[model samples]
Target: MIQLQSIVKQFKSKNGVFNAVDHVDIQVKKGEIHGVIGYSGAGKSTLIRCVNLLERPTSGKVIINGVDLTNASIEQLQQSRQKIGMIFQHFNLLKTATVYDNIAIPLKLLGYSRQDVEAKVTKYANIVGLSDKLASYPNQLSGGQKQRVAIARALSQEPEILLSDEATSALDPETTDSILDLLLEINEQLGITILLITHEMNVIQKICDYVYVLEKGKLVEHNTSIDLFTKPQHPTTQKFLNTISQRNLSDSLIEQLNLTGAVIRLTFVGESTGKPLIADVANHFNIQPNILAANIIELKNGIVGNIVVHINGTPSEINAITKYLTNNGVQIDMLGGTTNE
Candidate 1:
């Protein structure tokens, strides 16, 4: 397990003291993959480095497996860090070294026996599907293969936690998916507590069981992946969700034109039965809603849905329908056209 309490990291910049990570608190439970997301300059990288004492926090606690790393001695921290392995966005490998040696480096540093290092190097390389590339150099491998080599290197040490800092950012989409799948597989089979930091919401959505949204050194929102995806509360969080499910300005205008009256965004989740509720609205109000843009992304939670619709009816009728829909557990936001909420 990993925890950061009021973690702060500041650097003396030309303009002033710039805080890369400010008063941030995070807890990554054992056996769960937690995601941290933010745009460039959002301090996500700095925050992760602070975790293993790679970069010391100015004032805070970095606790790993019950050890407070911030206050730990160099010897203590070094020993603790061996249990926390990290991989970079760029595969930081010795280009001339074979994949076998690349992975063996970490074990070698720990003073592992030559035989033990060889066994682990081979085993981790195989785990990452690089058995054939053990003798291949970094330059000869593809981006994904190189990343696998890096992963094998990190896992070769057999760390309890893996801090993946934008580990897939440099790869193509196909390769990105492959890397993410591998991370998930590692988490599932190895039960390694992973803290994956990236600007990519899609990555977080795919592998993260829980996620936190960070902006300008502050925690904007944090929740389980399913809850955050279905019902994002913060504006920053909404923008991140919209990155993958972008609703264009032109699309909004089209919905407005088609509806020509009241428009509402409807969301459905657990205990909010949408089919019967919509049927009841139709029967009671004699109004049909022209559904505009609709999307249903299944999460670990039950099927959650969002739809843009134009309800055609008299003013009073629309008001009645809105009230009826709300009483049934449908979360409706009046992204209105002519109607005022």
Candidate 2:
């Protein structure tokens, strides 16, 4: 239930005026986890900040639930912001305050009653699994525990939209997965709309329903997480996917192996991932398939598989095999080497 229209945020630098976030448009539906991904300095962090007018756009509309935040009055904007919660890459908690005080402080400042503040803190601390750590200060907790405190503090506001700005980047892989799982639970159980910006494709792969790919302050691609992962169109997007999937083989490795025949990259999505397509091809066609690299990933939608293989066969036999695989819902990309065309 959030829409950003023609968003542009420019900054003055020694080089002159530059758009940190160029003209971009984004729509995040209610109760869905939408992700914006880009490498460092890709303007993704700046883009998410514009959602809550934390960084006001140069010229664009920031609409939340049909209200144009760009045109909102000071009081209105403040009121609107209370409905939006944000967590940062670094767990921004008061170091001296105990977890209970850190979560209760925001509610206290919001004019919540002492009893109400205690209740909200208790409820959210339990939700984020920090009930036992309420007495511990930030230094006494692990990185994951600190983030849980941050999450509990944010949820204390009862926000409808949660903005996560690289929330898991600072944690280790195991801790990252646990934090992601917690976010997924918050989205599913609380029905909160989550808009997270991360450079990690693994994060997007795990929880995002839809994905927006940003590069150098512009929107390059947007699609369902399944479609984007299965068939990445942009080179930048492909590079990000490669980080986690390893779908492409290095040319040096390919050359060193001295592979023969047509080298093909086959992509399998959903049900096709379970089929014996390679075996079927070998049985039906007079071709020998030598698999080079294979990877299967599970996304929010389902499974996607990427297999690189070298097929040794005559022109007609290779063509027949390619056609057979294509007919069975396999996407084929010729990496290098001979093909029937």
In terms of lDDT, which candidate is strongest?
Answer: 2
Q: Ten-residue segment with the worst summed lDDT in candidate 2?
A: 332-341
TM-score of 2: 0.98
Model 1, span 218-324: residue lDDT tens = 88899998789777899889888777763222456855475556777777777674476766777787777877777765553355667777886767878788788
Q: Highest TM-score: which candidate? A: 2
lDDT tens readout by residue for model 2, 192-292: 99999999999999999999999999999999999998889999999999998768887877778776667889999988999999999988875669998
RMSD (Cα, Å) of model 2: 1.3
Q: Please estimate how well model 1 matches the true structure, expressed as its whole-model Cα lDDT.
A: 0.85
Report, for every candidate in turn, its global Cα lDDT versus the true structure: 0.85, 0.92
RMSD of each: 2.6, 1.3
